[model samples]
Target chain A: MSGLKGWREIPIGGLILDAGNAEQYKTGSWRTYRPVWDEGKCIHCLFCWIYCPDSAIIVEEGKMKGIDLEHCKGCGICAEECPPKEKAIEMVLEGEGKGV
Target chain B: MGKIVALTGNDAAGTAMVQIKPDVVAAFPITPQTELMHKFADAVADGEVDTEFVLVESEHSAMSAAVGAAAAGARVMTATSANGFALMWEIVYIAASNRLPIVMTLVNRALSAPINIHCDHSDSMGGRDAGWIQIHSENSQEVYDNLIQGVKIAENKDVLLPVMVTSDGFILSHTLERMEILDEEDVHRFVGEYKPAHTLLDVDHPVTFGPLDLPDYYFEHKRQQVLAMEEARRVILEVGKEFEKLSGRGYGFLEEYQMEGAERAIVALGSTAGTVKQVVDALRERGERVGLIKLRVFRPFPKEELLEALREVKVVAIFDRSHSFGSFGGPLFTEVRSVLYGSDISVEVLNYIYGLGGRNISLEEIEGVFSDLQGVIERGGVKERINYLGVRE
Candidate 1:
């Protein structure tokens, strides 16, 4: 809040003049649980990427790279939708691991 | 000057909408307001106008679609009354807070519980504080004129807020009256082109709307709305002046009838003002110093103008067609009194809650109000702060 614009300086009509500024704000802090992706048990079927509500699943060359935890809301949809056979992703309590 | 034509209030509103030809209109049917939409929709279907008429399932969806279209930077319009307006209540605030210049016709009707489709101010008064400029119409002509002016008022860059132009339900909506309507080309010239400063469709200058405005900046945005409303007072008068030039019909925040040298007066809104005008003329003929201040614009509250209008008056009877339950007085009464509060004005004021649920406030009742004001002056003060008119004992 240190240099936040006052009412006079801000854009009229409460519009965010900068488009796609959502990335500048992180939603990961809102999470009570975070999704953990296992590299070894991965099927790379890309189900987690497809199910992420926040588009937090990072995909490179059409393959799952890792979770973009900065944006992940930890809704457990990625974990819930992961095939039971592979069980590549699991929900863990937030702050359980180092930088989890 | 425009040519004279006979039209009902709904038809008059529809005529204005058809002429303005907003880029988009999302409509759902409701009493009083339905015919206005029908007029616009028929024009769209007949290829008379190129307005995109979206048939929404409900008033909520109607307003949501209107908001979306307006954010995309299209000139948008919609209409509703009573419960339909109530249904659109949530999105109505969203439309205003987002600062979309959407012009809507609110044919004033009673909000439901008993559910009667007739004329009343309950619907529009319910939205008096929703950040939209509220303009009340006395008759069909004003309904047509206000709708045309509303577009310009809402789209004014200095005041880019939604405006709800209201006509009393059924009283004006279903009643035919002779009024002048401008040619489509003339209306086009007056309203001119809508050049939105920022739009979702303007990819070259991208922007976002309806973002999560938390405590950090929510207060600031609301402050912006407050300034915009303040600016609207100037813009509404400016537009009214420009419109007067075109149509020869002058309008202001409030229209004073026989106010000069009057000691007692009645202040009111909507179709009741027309009835009150008749009483004023009758009383004036009988050498009674009674006048009226028919409030044309209510949302901006017209505080200074009202003070100026009521300056010479000693006793005032304010007629509110809607009740503010459990409050000291009706909405108009409280507002008029509040404006005079802490001021040099030492006028005696009274509130008469009248015509609720579309009960007729006849000419005699208006005269009775003036008589009551006369009695207040005779007695030197008010006995009751709030009184009901035209209701059973």
Candidate 2:
């Protein structure tokens, strides 16, 4: 009953990506790179959050946060503008069939 | 045999339709194109042309009926002018998008807030982006020939787009001229039968025509329409070649008159092209390096061909009968600038808005346009507002 009853209907939240958090998820070949945030060298300057054209980056508790890749076009403007001691934002190659 | 009988442009179009023998003709009479519908009605009454003539109550209904007839897999033809054409605006776009091979004759007239029934390009210009292949004719002969060729071009399997054969209203529609009429048998052989890829009345096939499309598919359909128009450029030339073989007069997408080695040139379309050419010949007799480029096809505008024709000229004066309000530029002038935006050849382009509201464009006024262009060429440029020739101060 536990496995079969719960399995028949997947949670709606899990079935579809949350629209608000979509910017953190990356999909498609058109997106060449996914933004990676480096926690160690990060400063809470929030320059990346302010400059991301897609508003992909979100800031909470006065700290730099990760991007919602689902809605990000992978334009890399945030990666270029990161103001940490070492670049906190870096672009990572997206895996095949991983992005929408 | 060549006939010397004088006939109006509407008569010429109706005569060509008779000779071509289309399956259906739906029209509402509007000046100055009522004669065309009248002649067709007479022909139908006499049992000369075996075709269905639908006399609709309104121009809107006329175009809608034509669209329906075309959808039923019949070769359809219609004619309207000015306000009458404006009335048909909604269905005109549908006729092209639905890919119905309907051929329409638009006797170009000035649109009215003040109500003027005169020769102007406003009617056609207003509907420029309505997705029809627009062809302008310079004279009655071109009008007659274009109507004949329009059917062949529109029905070509590779290019199934609606076509508009436009001539100057009143000026061309009412003017009488001697034109060569092709033998009826030859025209019949040329146009052939109307065979549609998808038809509304085809019960066996049962295809959905003009269904509601969502945004994703709507864009794809428009893209396909664009591809069809680009394909029409080649189809038009091929059709023109076949027509030349049959009729002995060659027509290009753009006709050049003494353009080679000319220092200055005037660019215009419709019946005014003939008038401009006459003026060019006279000026050339006085050793002026002036020429005329008559644009035959306006929509799917012959850009490369136009630039090629005008590349060597130092100054180009565009004579536009229609104005693009609030843009401070004539429609033709805007298109010309867009065509030569990044090109190395920088010919000085000037816009002269003339002959609007059926005002007579005399030879003197045409010469004045050339004189303005001459001034620009001599002094490198001239400062003048959009010169409206014959506009009462």
Candidate 3:
């Protein structure tokens, strides 16, 4: 409901002309759990960057920046995709500071 | 402003394409239809017409490319037969829903599995509900004329729907006939320039072509298509009238042949209508009260005209070339019968499935149906509603 519209507010053919406008909405509010990235334990393999459906993982110069919470729905996909035994990422309850 | 020439229906349609000189033509080769695009490609190679010819890998890609060109607001066209049209089935709906006025020359061939490569209405009939303006041609002349007018009818501001001009495969597509070709200038004047209302190539406006619509606006968009179809009826007739001005050949949603003051009639489409007309003439010479209804437009099914024309006819039968298996009868039969529902008119409608896989329908076979109608008229009831014409069983 954020800048996007239902059919009633669209043209006959429903064309989305305003490019990159989906990023305006704060979809992170929908997530009850958010992924906490541990900088110390992080290997920055960028598994989350490759698998984010919404392009929610922030990447800079081919390296993982962090989770882009503005568009992330907090699916904990990054935690699941983390490397074995490293446990570089953990999902924590919303507004509970750091999971570590 | 037209030249008389001998050409097959496929070439005639290709001749029309050459005159219209569309911006892009994306197509794949299939029987009967391949020659139509071959002629178009020849025109492009010989510098007769300036066109970007795309030899796509498959019919699905053919339609996909055609849809893309159309969205970019280019005047585009293509040709395909049975299985090729089936391959294009996915984008067929998308082209219409996107409201692109892309015209296609659909040479009708029987759908495969029993593996047919010959004439039948099943190809176009299969895509009947695909939201495109469908025009049926009776002969080479009609094929050429319909394609030209088809371009206009589809591009009409009110219509803005894709159009499929069909000619029966091999029968009309390969059979050579004498026809008049309109002058390139006259065709250019009539077709004019295509101006899409909303083009994907419009950078300033930046309108998207295909967008996902949830339930909220989907119904409204579909309703708009219904309205566009409603407008198409008027546009088709108007374009036909305009075409008549140049070529002296006119068109209508459905054609009534010797229907006046007649108590009996045979209805059909494509080249079979030509054979039926000859039989009707012979029957009339014997003082028979038989007439013929050659349906030209199947979609936006001419319900009113059909009802009004058949109101007084005591007995009528439709020669359907394609069978709608598991249904009551063939595609044309189901539709023509649907319009005559609840009518007080005592019209005994019969459906005859004929020419499934290029089965030759002789004049004697056509006369037999008329004779059966005569018997039904005299006896007051039909023996079987749906019957096969020439199959050995």
State the RMSD for candidate 1. Answer: 1.6
| Preferred candidate (DockQ higher): 2 or 3 | 3
Residue lDDT tens for model 1, B291-355:
99999999898999999998899999988989889999999999999989998998999999988
Off by over 4 Å in 2: A1-100, B1-4
Question: For model 2, what is the alpha-carbon lDDT of residue B278?
Answer: 87
lDDT of 2: 0.83
Q: Where does model 1 exceed 4 Å of error?
A: A61-63, A98-100
Candidate 2 steric clashes:
13
TM-score of 1: 0.96
TM-score of candidate 2 against the unseen true structure: 0.79
Candidate 1's displacement at residue B342, Å, is 0.2
The full ranking of all candidates by lDDT, starting with the best, is 1, 3, 2
**Top candidate when judged by TM-score against the true structure:** 1
Measured against the true structure, the TM-scores of the candidates, in listed sequence, are: 0.96, 0.79, 0.89
The true-versus-predicted C-alpha distance at residue B322 of model 1, in Å, is 0.4
Ranking by TM-score: 1, 3, 2
